[model samples]
Target: MRSATESQKDSAVLAELIRTLESWKETVVIAPDTPDADALASMFSLAKAFGDGDGRSAKVSLPENSLSQRLAFLHEWANLPVATAEDFARADGFVVVDTAKKSRCNLREDVPEDWDRGRTILNIDHHASNTRFGTVNWVVGEASSSAELVYRLLQAWGWPIDPLYASLLYAGIHTDTSGFSLPNTSKSAVAAAAELVERGADVVELGERLCRSQRLSEFKLLRTIYANTQLAADGRIAYSTADYQEIADAGCSAADVDDQVSVPRSLHGTRLAMLFTEGVRGKTRINFRGDSGVPALPLAKAFGGGGHDAAAGAIIAGPVPEVVAQVLPEAESYLNRLAQKP
Candidate 1:
C-alpha cells in the first residue's frame, strides 16, 4: 500500500477518471492489440464497473484476432464485445488500459491520430516506460499489474465486485507477477489478490489453467528453444531464435513460444534472456527477460518497443537471422557495460 501522501496523489488521478466516466455519455475501452491477461482484465473491469448503471455502458475496442483460450471461461472474457475502427473513431472518449503510448495500443495509425483530437483519453498502466499519452494519465510504475490499479479504483469508487470481476482481476495479477514469483510482485498486488480470493475468485482453477496446464505445442517449442539457446557477453546474456517454419515443424505455433523466453534467464549464469520469433507479415517479435542487475527497458526502447524494466518486447521488420545479427551485438555490448559497473 502507498503512504498517506502517495495515496492522496493517486486519488487525485483516479478522481479524474471517475469524473471523466460520469460526464461522458458513451466511452470506448481499448486494450493493446496483443493484450495479456492484465490488459484484458483492466479493460473488462473498467467497462463493467463504469458502464453498469442506468443508461451508462462502454464498448470495448480490441483486435478481432486477439482472443486466447486461456481466459475464455470468465464471463467478462466471453461476453465482452469487440470493437471495430468505426467504434473507436466515433466514440466520445477512450479509456485505454495496460498500454502506455498510443502506438503501443497497436491500433491503426489513423485511429489514434483521430482519437487524440479534442477527445478524452485515459491512459492507465503500470509500465515504468509509459509515455503518459493520455489526457489523464494514471500510471503507477511500482504496481504489479494494471489490474492491481483497477482493483484499487473499484474499491475507491465503491463499484460492484462480483465473482466474475474478482476472477478476472485475479488472473491479471497472477499471470503478470508469474504467480507472485517475479520481482514486480508487491504488497499491494498480494493484498488485491487476497481480496479477490475473498470475493470468490477461483485461484485454484486459474493456477491449473495458467501455470499447470501446457499444450504439446508448448513442449515442442521448449525443445526448440533449448536446442537453439546461445550464451554471450561472458555468459551473462543468453539468446535464441525460432522461425515460423521451425515452430511449425515442431507441430506448434508462435503462441507456444511466448512464455519460453524467460526460461534461459533462470539459468545460474545468465542475467538476461532473449528470444526472437518470426511473426506474420514479415515481422520478428523479440521477448526479453532480465535479472535485477540487467534491465530490459533500454533494449526494448532501442527498438521502438516499450515495457517494464525486467520484462519487455519489441517487433522488428525481419528476416529473423538478420534481426538476430543486428541485435546480438547490442545485447552483448549492454551486458558488457553492466559487467563493468560497480
Candidate 2:
C-alpha cells in the first residue's frame, strides 16, 4: 500500500490536469473506453467541467456502439457524439478516462498514426493495471472508482455538480466498488459518496437500480452457470463456463453474464475462480478472480490479456472446451504453487 504522502502526490496530479485543460484554447474531446457506466459517467463529468470553463467548446465521443442500454439513463447519453480516432486526430486535446491503455480503448484501426503525439492527452483512471500511456497521467489505484477521481477533478476545477451529475457519478462509483463491498473500498470512497449524496445522489434508489434490478433472462443464465460450477481437487479452485448455445437459450447478453463470473471466485474456500464465456467471432473470454497473494495478471498475460492481481481476464481464440483444457491446468498449477509456498 502507498503511504498517505504518496496518495496525496497522486491526488495533486488532478490539479495539474485541470490547469492543462484550463489553458486549452481549441476543441477538446473527452473519450472513455468501452462505454461502461464508469467510463461514461467519468467522461461526461469531465466534459461538463471543460465546457463550463473558459468558454471552451468540448465534445464527448466514444467508440461506436459501445454504450450499453443498461447505462442509457445517463444525462449525456442522448446527446453525446460518437467519433472515431480520425475525429480525435483533429481535436486540440484528448482526455482518456476510465481506461489507460490503447488496447482497451478499442480505437478504430483507420486512425492516423501519431495522431495524439502533439496533442495534450490526459489519462485518468482507477485501474491498478493502468499502462500510464498519457502525457499527463492521474492514475489513482487507491481510489474506489474512476467516478470518485472524476468527482475530485470536478471539485478541484470548482465546477457545479447538479443532481444529474451527482447521480451519474454515484452510479459509476457504486457499480465499480460493488456498493463498497469490494476489497478496494476506502475512507475516501465513503467521503466521496457522502458528498455526492448530499448533492442529491439517491443512494437507496441507485442501489436498487444497480443491484436489485436484473432481467429474468440474466437470472436464468446465472442459474445455469451456478449449477455447472466445479471445484478443484483441493476445493480451493473453482471453474464454470457458458457455451454459445446455453447463452442463446437463456436469452441473455454477454454483459448479463459478465457480473456472474466473479461469484464462484468469491467462495470462502476457493483461492481462485474462473468463468469462461463464448465471445464474438469464435473467441472465448475467460475471467479470472483470486484471493489475496494470488497473481492473476501474469496468468492473464499468458493468454494475451491483462488485468490486476485479484481480477483479470483474457480472450482466447478457440472453443470453450479447448480453452478450459488449457486454462484449468494453469490454474491448478498456480494453486499448487500457493500450497507449496511457506
Candidate 3:
C-alpha cells in the first residue's frame, strides 16, 4: 500500500500527463529496450490514442523486432509499427511507457541526441525505481501494470476505448501479473480487468494467447533449463545460464530465451530464480523472479538494473559465465538475509 503522500504525488503526475497529451502531436511512444507483453501493450495503446487524432500520427519505437509471435495479435489489432530513424527525426515529442529509467530506453543508441535535447518527454510507468526522468512522469507503482495506468489515463481524458484496445490493455495486465497470480495483482487490477472485459476484451482468448501459446524453440529452451538448473542457498535459490551456443543449439532466438526465468521459478522449494542469458554480444541479460519472502529489486539494482519486487531484470556487459559467477553469490546472499529476517 502506498502512503497518503505518495498517492497524492502520483495523482499530480497523472494529471500532468493528461494535460501534456492534450497538446502532443506527432508524438513517438517508446517501450523498454526488450519489452514484455506489458510494455508492448502499453506502447500500442498510447500510439492508438494519439494517432487517431486529425492531422496527428504517433510512432512506436522499440530496440528491435524482438516481440514474440504470441504478441502478433496486437500487431493485427493496431498498426503498431516499429519506428524508423526518419520517424524519430520527424517526431515532435516522446511518450515512454512501461519503462522506469531514461537510460534503459536505449534511445541514446537508437535515436539522435537532440531527440532528448529540448523536446517534451512523457514518462509513464509502474516501477517504484523510476527516476521521474521525463518533463512529466506519471508513475504509480501501486498499479498492477503500466497498462492499467494507461487504461485509467484514457478514462480520465475521455478517450475512446474499443475492444481491440481493451484486449491490448488486458494482455499487459494479465502477463505482468502472471494471470493475476502474483502478489502485485491488486484489487484495482481486478476492477480494471472487469471494466476491460465489459469494454470487450476477450478474456479467454487473451489468456490462451498470453499463457498457453508457446513456440517449439521456447519449449526447447525450457527443457534445456530443466536439464541444467543449479540450486543455491539451500534450495531457496535456483539459477541457470544459457550461452550463445546452448541457446542456438536449442533453436531459440534472443526473444525465445527471455521467458526462461519461469522454468527455475517453477521449482517447488525455490524462493528466488535467476536466468542469465547471453543474447547480444558482450552482454548478458539477467532475469529475476522471487517468491513471497524474496524480493528481486535489490539484487537487480545491485547489478545496476531495476524492476518490481517479485520480477526484475538487468543487463550486464560481460560473458555469460562471468556474469553468472558474479550474480549467483548475490542471490544466495540475499536469500540468506531473508532467511535470517525472523
Candidate 4:
C-alpha cells in the first residue's frame, strides 16, 4: 500500500498520464533492449487502453523480428509491428514502459537522441533508477512491475481490462516478482495479481507458458549453467558463468536463460547470487540477486547498472573470467563490511 504522501504522488502522476492519453490521437509503445515479458505486457496493455471507442490509434513497436522461444506466442498474439521512422514521425506521443533510461531503449536507429523533446513522452516504469525523462513520468519503484503500474493507471482512467491484457499483466507480474519470491512483491502487487486473475486472466495457461515449461534449448543452457556454478565468500556468494560459445552450443540466446542465478541463490546461506553471461564479445552481462539485508542495486550501480535492491544487472566491458575475478572480490568486500556493521 502507498503511504499517504505516496498515494497523493501516485494520484498526481496517474492524472498526468490520463491527461496525456486523452490528448494523444496516436500512441506508440516501445520497450528496452531485449524486452522481457513484463516489458512486452506493460507496453501492450497500455496500448490496449488507448483505442476502445476513443478512435485513437495505439500500436506496439517490437523492432525485433522474433521473440524468445518461450515468448514466441507474442509474435502472433502481440500483433506488434517493427518500428519505422514514419511511425515516430506520425505518433502524437510515445510511451516507454519498463525501461530505466533512454540509452537502453530499443528504438529505431533514426529516432532522435532528444526524441522526448517537443513530444508527450510517458515514462512508465517500476525502476527507481528511471531518469524521469518523460514529460509525464509515472514510476512506481515499489510496484512489482511496470505491468502493475499499467493496471493502476488503466483502472484509474476507467479503461476496461480485456481478458487478453489481463492474462499478459498477470504473467508479467509473476515473472517480474520472481513468482512472488522477491521482496518487492508487496500486498498491493498480490492484490493487483488477484484482480487480474479474477478479471478473466488465464492463470493456468500463463503458468504453463511462463513457468511449467522450458524449451529444449533452455534445458541445454541449464546443464551448462549447472556445470559452471560456483560458490565464494564463505558460501555467502554463489555465481555461475556462461560464455558466448557455451550459450551458442546450447542453441540458446541470453533471454533463454531463466534467471539461473536463482540456482546459486537457493543455497541455504547465500546472501548474493550472480550469473555472469558473456553474450557479446568483450562484454559480460551480470545478473545480481540478493537476500534480505544485502542490497544488489548498489553493486549493480558500482558497475554502471541499475535495478531493484533485490535484483539488478550490469553489462561490463570485460571477458567472463575477468569480470568474475573483479566482481567477486567487490561482492565479498561488501559482504565483509556488512558483517562488520552493527
Candidate 5:
C-alpha cells in the first residue's frame, strides 16, 4: 500500500497528466473495462473533459454488451462518441480509466499485439490490485471510486461539471461504494456526492432508476436463488447456486444474475455468503461476500480470481454442482476461522 505521502505524490501525477494531455495534438481515445457502471461513467466523464477543448476530440470505447440496462442511459445519454477498439485505434492517444489491469479491460483479444508504444497512455484507477500498466499511471487505491478521482481531476483542470457528466459520475460513485455503505468510503466521497447533487445530479431520480427499477427477469432470477439458499451451522455461512438451466429459464442475462448471487450474504446471521453460477465457458463463477474481516480476496486468488476483502470472485472450471461441492466446505472453513477471531 502507498503511504499517505505517497498517495499525495500520486495525486500530483494527475496534474502532470493534464499537462501532457494539453500538449497533445492528436485525438484522445478513452477506454474502460466491460460490464461496469463505474468504468463507463469515468470513461465518459474523462472524454468530455478532453473533447470540450480546442483541437482535441475524444471517443469512448468499450466491449459489446458491457453496459447493462441500468447503465444503457449512458449510450443515448450523451453525445460523446462511443465505439469499439477498432474505432479507438483511429485516435492518436489512449486514456484508460477505472481499470488498473489490462486483463480486466476485456480488450486483450482486440488490442493489437504490437500497438504503437509512443502514443501516450494514461491509466487511472482505484483498485488496490492495479497492475499500474501504462505510460502514465495515476492509481489512488484509497479514492472511494474512479469517478471520485475523475471528479477531483476535473476540478483540478478547472472543467465545469455539466449535468450529464455530474449524473454519470454520481452513478459511478454510488454503485462502487454501494451507496456509501462500503468500508473505504471517505469524506471526499461524500463531498463529491454533494457537489454532484448541487450540479443537478438528481439523486432521487438516480436512486429510483438504479435501485428501485428491476426487470421481471431479474426478479425471477432472484426468486430462484432465494429458493436454493442454504444456511450453514448457526447461520454463519450461507451458500447458493444457480445452474445454467435455471438462469436460462429465468430469461435473465449473466449481468442480471451477477448481482443475485450475493443475496445469500444478506442473511442476518451470515458472516460469509457464497454464490456459484455456471458460466458458458465450462467455468463456474463464484462470488463471495462477508460482513466479517475474513479477507476473501486471498481465497478468491487461490482460485484464479481477486477483489476486495469484503467482496471477491473466482472462476473455476467444472459443473455448478461440482464447483459448489468444492467451494462450500472451503467457505465454511473460512467462516470458522473468522468466528474464532479473538
Candidate 6:
C-alpha cells in the first residue's frame, strides 16, 4: 500500500492534469510503438471523448502496420484518417500514454518537426522508470495501469464513459495485469475491473478476443520460443532466443510477439526469465521477468533498460548471440545477489 503522503501527492498531480486539459483546444495522443491493449485502450478513451463536435479536437497517432492483429479492431472502430498531418500541424498539445521515455513512443517521420518541444506534453504512465519527460507528468508506478488512471481522470473531468470506453478500459487493465495473475495485480485493480464490468464492459468477449485470439503466425512463433528455451544456474534462470530467420520462417513480424516472453517466465522454479529476439540482424530486444524474490528493473537497468519490478525490456545494438552473452550472466548475477540479500 502506498503511504498517505504518496497518495496525497498523486491526487495533487491529478488535479493539475485536469486543470491543464480544461483549457487545451487541440491535442495529439500518442501510444508507443508495438502498443499493447493497455496503451491503445487508454488512448482510445481519451481520443474519442474529445472528438466529435467537442471543441477539444483530440487526435491519436496511429502508425502504419504497427498494431498487432488482435488489436486491429481499434483502427477501424475509431475510423481514424490515414494521415492527420493537418491535425497534427494544428494541434496545441500532445499526450503520451503507457510510455516511459520519448524514445519508446513512435515518433515517425511524418510527425510535425516541432513535436517534441513544439507545445505542451502530458506524460501519463504506470512504470517506475518513467523519466518525467513531459510538460506535466503523472507517473504513478503503483497504479494498476494507465487505463485505470484514465478512468479516474474521465470521472473527475465529468466526461461520460459509455459502454465503448468502458470496454477499452477493461481491455487495458485485463492485459496489463496478465489476467490478474501477475504480481502487480492489487485490490484496487480488482475493484476497478468489477466496476467496469458493471458499466457494460463485455468481459467474456474482451477475454475471448484479447487472450484466446492468436493468428497462425503467432502460434508458429510460440513454437519457436518454446523450442529455444534454455536453462541456466540450475534452473534459477530460464531464457529463450530467436533470430530474424526463425521469426520470418514462423511468418510472424516483430509486432506479432505480444507475450512470447511469458513462455519462459512461466517456469516453476525460475527466479529470472529472459527472452531475446534479434531484429533484422541489427538490434536485439531483451525482455526480463522476475519472480517475487527478484526485481526485473535492476537487471534491465544494468544493461541500460527500464521498466517495472516484474517486467522490463531493452533493445541493445548486437546480434542475438552477442546480446545473449552480455545479458545472461547479468541475469544470473542479479538473482544471486537477491538470494544473498538478508
TM-score of each: 0.91, 0.87, 0.93, 0.95, 0.89, 0.95
Between which residue pairs do clashes occur in model 5?
Answer: none
Model 1 per-residue lDDT at 16: 87
Q: Which lDDT tens digits does candidate 1 get at residues 1-342?
A: 578998789999989888887887777888876677788888888888867867876777665445544444553453765656677766778889999678767464445556656788988899988899899999998899999999988887888789888988999999899889999888878988999999989888878877777666666777888888888877888888788788777776543455678767767888889989874636888998989878999988899888898799888998688999988899888888877899
User: Model 2, 224: alpha-carbon shift in Å?
Assistant: 3.3
TM match of model 1 to true structure: 0.91
Over 113-156, each residue of candidate 2 has an lDDT whose tens digit, in order, gives 67676878889887677889888998886677789989988888
Position 297, candidate 1: lDDT: 91
Each prediction's number of clashing residue pairs: 0, 0, 0, 0, 0, 0
- Poorly placed runs, candidate 2 (over 4 Å): 1-4, 25-35, 75-79, 84-86, 108-117, 255-257
lDDT leader: 4
Better of 1 and 2 by TM-score: 1
Q: Rate the local accuracy (lDDT) of all candidates.
A: 0.80, 0.74, 0.83, 0.84, 0.75, 0.83
Look at candidate 4 and tell me the lDDT of residue 257.
Answer: 55
Give the TM-score (vs. native) of candidate 2. 0.87
Compared with the true structure, the alpha-carbon lDDT of candidate 1 equals: 0.80
Give candidate 6's TM-score.
0.95
- Please provide, for model 5 over 2-34, each residue's C-alpha lDDT reduced to its tens digit, 9 standing for 90 to 100: 578986886679778888888765554444443
* Residue-level lDDT tens digits of model 3 in 1-342: 678998788777778887777776788898877678888899999899988877888878765556665676776777766777778877778899988888777453557766766778899999988988988888887789999999988887788899999999999998888888889899889999999999999889987887788777777777888888988878888888888877788777676655678878888998999998887767899999989878899899999989888888899999998998899887887888877887
- Give the per-residue lDDT digits (tens) of candidate 4, residues 1-342: 678999998898889888878988887888877777898888877876785536887777676533577876644565655557777878898999999987888776677766555888889999888888787888888889999988998899997787887898888899999898889889988999999989988888888988868888888887888888899988999999999899889898765654778878877888999999987778899999999999899999999999888888899998899999999999999889988999
How far residue 38's Cα lies from its native spot in candidate 3, in Å, is 0.3
